[model samples]
Target: MNSDDPLSLTSKTSLGAYYESHHVIGKRLGQSFEEGQRGPLLKRWIGTGRRVLDLGGRDGQLTRHFVDGNHVTIGDIDAGAMRLAREALGVDTVEVNLNEALPFADASFDVIVMGEVLEHLPYPHLTLEQVRRVLAPGGQYLGSLPLAYHWKDRWDVFRGKKLWMARDPTHLQFMRYSDLRKLLSTYFEVVEIVPLKGGKKAVRWPDQFARVVAFHARKAAG
Candidate 1:
């Protein structure tokens, strides 16, 4: 892959178009539900006056929210997605391949948001380490990942159905709640972790019940 090629190491399919197409209608609908649930929770932490990096922010839907009083930058492997982010949200963009070191200086951002992105990386630990490095001291990292699912992933493991994420060619990792928290704790001080789309009762409920969980953690002093 040509290093300069925006499409290098990424699916040839237009990332922006994929988000807008019927194939992702379910995901779009889910975002609508999450808006009323997780969106507000994130706004309080990610809002005004911070330098934010929206990693894997396809098309800027989540990116636009943080742009109110913040400097938001989009980073993704797909050139088409970053273009959409620039054109639609008027934010800056950096083409990033998550498997490699991020192309930014240390402590470069105050907040790093990586919604629906952790699962897609081949080396999530290395990527998080980079995220920790770029994040300013006292900076927060907010992102979401799938919690183990009974019907989808767990069932596949038990009944031997094909892996759930394999359907999406880009997905390269799968995680459970404990695995995620343990990993985050290795680099950050986890402040909050909650289901992004549920009622108050969902707060204390087991993580396996929810399809996704959102996290907000501050960069460790290390």
Candidate 2:
């Protein structure tokens, strides 16, 4: 919205369209979701769960880890990707946009997994609110996203470059640990924050040393 007037109606590529292009690229390159500690962490944290919602879970890449013990339902924006996910994983899929209200009742899910999806949202707060609303009391929210405040990112600023890690045109939010923690605190009680893929320094200072961070949070009991 920065490029346009404060009130003028403007147009941009739909989220589904943009992700559809990346989905095609990812498939062609034989790229699965980040094949590292992220999957194992999600599996262990969300163990033996049913009534799970994999938000924006395209093609069931990460969903495979925890889908065995749970009745997993995927909610995503792209139809083509949902088709692929169904074929690959046989999970129920819902076609919904995170930019708008989710089409689920209150307290609909026991666990919600949002892997690598938050940074792409234009209205992340609204989606967080929706997730909070759809979760049952004491339900858990597990999420992962790239953190943009590592030492390498700081180095880019010194070299007069954009503070972006990859060539993703859709990454609208580049958050540090504190930024995202503050946002998550508004809706849930944050229980854990695990930083991934950095040196030993990351264990002490995840906000500055880690490249990606995963968060575990729980809704307050009613």
Candidate 3:
């Protein structure tokens, strides 16, 4: 593959392969999910008793929290993660590439959860369009993003430092909190938006201080 060519679906598939070897700092790692940063927010926002689609939810780690009493289908580009989510949680799985349109029927789910996955997409706006299309009227969209406008990072740029949020090359896009908010508002109504790891300062100025932001938004009824 030409290095200049855009990241291919095969490359994205390879990226998903990493989930099999690693787990986050929460319940998947035998630690308390509730104790982890932003854990309480995710659990509270993602409730049960409805159909849920977990975009890029690899290996049933974060999906386990609301899996019970709610029917779930995990969509990912990784075949290994798809098989493992089924083996781990007995949930349905679909192999999907978010760069393309979603295959589900219109208004297919009561909720859609996309966590830390959008930044890796070169076409986030396109994917979020599908997210809006698949969600049932008034259904929720729950997700998180690494805030690109963190004050420290801004300071670093002022001091002539170059940085990327993580070592992972898949993170293809970064935007200020306001930029993200505007994009999301195109499809979903902002119900609540909050910061993670931003502390008291973030409460007042999330766009300036938050390391990440979690959100609960609603699809408008037709």
Candidate 4:
């Protein structure tokens, strides 16, 4: 079983089943917060009426925000999740394995959203390279990743609260702020790095203790 293959769930682990069962309910709670908190920021960066891809978008929860006045497509490895996304969000979807080359034509998207997906992948650099390939010139790729060692997650571990948001077995990679910038710079020119919730002041402080950080990166125009 290739760990890099996003569809390689052949290990028959309970994790896939857990995601299938909890994808909807869990995302309901999560999407509410994200829509209220992060959606506006992403919209500001993404603008309106352009091709957008939500990579690893489970159940198209986050895809809903962009659908009203824009073209949105979702890609994920889970068939159940993709089915739910199409049924619930009424958006286009394609099966994808992040470790493998994306199944889209070159420069197929104007904007790409990759929220809370990088930390789960085994090869983030390769994923970013593929993202670069699929993105049009000057296209934007927006993403979010949790801090590698947040104090709250540490507290959660201390309290043995390993349920739901507390801990995830699927999180294979942990990264710091510097690590994120460096990684994305390999394939993109990072234009902005901001906090998921707080506004401008958070950018000044750039809290290392924060749970997650979001970014806006662009493909260089040839």
lDDT (10s digit) by residue, model 1, range 1-222: 544333443464564443334224334322432555556677787879899998977667766666888899988765655677788879999888778899999999999998888887778889999999999998999988766553446777788776666655556777766778888999899998887644554566645555678899999665
Q: lDDT per residue, candidate 4, 57-169, as tens digits?
A: 87776677677777889898767877878898788999788889999999999999998888888888899889999999999999787766455556776897652343555
Error of 4 at 202 (Å): 4.8
By lDDT, the best candidate is 2
> Candidate 3: global Cα-lDDT?
0.76
Candidate 4's TM-score: 0.80
Candidate 2 lDDT over 1-222, as tens digits, reads 432221222243666765666566445222445547778888888888568999988878788888898889999887777888789889999988998999999999999999988998889999999999999999999989888968988998889887764446567898988898999999999999887766788779888888788899999998
- TM-score, each model? 0.79, 0.89, 0.83, 0.80
How high is the CA lDDT of each candidate model?
0.74, 0.83, 0.76, 0.75
Off by over 4 Å in 2: 1-13, 26-30
lDDT (tens digit, per residue) of candidate 3 on 118-149? 77788988999999999999899988878775
> Positional deviation of 96 in candidate 4, in angstroms?
0.6
Off by over 4 Å in 1: 1-36, 149-152, 155-160, 197-202
State the displacement of the C-alpha of residue 155, model 3, in Å, after optimal TM-score superposition: 3.0
